[model samples]
Target: MRLEQWSRIMGKLAIDDEVLEEVAAAARSRGVSSESLAQELLLEGLRGHKSKESLRQLMEAIAAMTSRDVEQTDSVELLREDRDR
Candidate 1:
């Protein structure tokens, strides 16, 4: 809604027709303009980019999780026990 944000999105961007149509349909179903829907989609993508963790960090997290003893236990119980520990 701000002038800076509006200026940033003024340039053209490429998208497939099927994806555009889907975005338009969702906008209509939600009683919003297609432009608004597109903006929402773009913002969601940008937020995801900004928040994504590095591959090394992800691998480290996975290694830490898998190193714990989870044999013969349901995932939920394993997670609870891990958290308790």
Candidate 2:
């Protein structure tokens, strides 16, 4: 691990008291700091969002492929015609 990875940059984050309590409890349960728990949750959410975007791109590509006529027709006949030439 890099030295920077171990360093924490202080930043002010706003959360309701109930939410803060929940995160604190979760952190305690996981044996990690509240800040670390929050960071982990945030990263997980970001990764999920990225996965959604990738899925959307794949869906669009599939839709595009289905929208077009891509199948080759009369393959044997075309090959025979070519061979005759």
Candidate 3:
């Protein structure tokens, strides 16, 4: 979407130029338009704000997967282990 369209949709949120530049740089690095990246960030923020419990559950799931011990294994495997336990 065009910058003007994004501005119209986002209204008057005072984002600093330096932060905008960083967002643009990151978007470029990821091969996505800055507008799209900004939209994703906006949507993510909205979701987190509107339903913090959902976000908390998502974070917990991610942490469970990432912080699993060697013996713990993947979530699917963990589930099976739990069933057998």
Candidate 4:
């Protein structure tokens, strides 16, 4: 799942002509081949997906913690008390 752990695995993707044109233009602007640009975009997208999954997991954890019967305190007051401690 990490870029450093990635190996050269040949795969084919069918991109729409319009999208390919956009990718080609982007690649030309960056002075790289379309294939490289596509790979970079795919990696970036995968990283973003991983980040989103992490955030979702964190939210679920926060939800579980808050679902307890403990009384909720004012966050600002709690921070102030902690800071003064």
TM-score of each: 0.50, 0.50, 0.46, 0.50
Q: Predictions ranked by lDDT, top down?
A: 3, 4, 1, 2
Compared with the true structure, all predictions reach lDDT values of 0.74, 0.74, 0.78, 0.75
- Report the alpha-carbon TM-score of model 1 versus the true structure: 0.50
- Backbone clashes counted, model 4: 0
lDDT for each residue of candidate 3 in 1-33, tens digit (9 for 90 to 100): 444555787775667777788889999999998
lDDT of 4 at 52: 70
| lDDT per residue (tens digit) for residues 30-76 in model 4 | 99977788789989998767577889998999889775788889899
Q: Report the lDDT tens digits of candidate 1 across residue range 1-85.
A: 3334445677656667777778878999999977898898889998777334676788788788774676556889989999999
For candidate 3, give the lDDT of residue 77: 86
Candidate number with greatest lDDT: 3
Which 10-residue span in candidate 3 carries the lowest summed lDDT? 65-74
- Which ten-residue region of model 4 has the weakest summed lDDT? 1-10
How many angstroms is residue 37 displaced in model 4 relative to the true structure, after the best TM-score fit? 0.3
If both were scored by lDDT, which would come out higher, candidate 1 or candidate 2? 1
How far does residue 67 in candidate 2 sit from its true spot (Å)?
15
Please give the clash total of every predicted structure, in order: 0, 0, 0, 0
Model 3: lDDT to the true structure: 0.78
Alpha-carbon error at 8 in model 2, in Å?
A: 11
lDDT value, candidate 2, whole model: 0.74
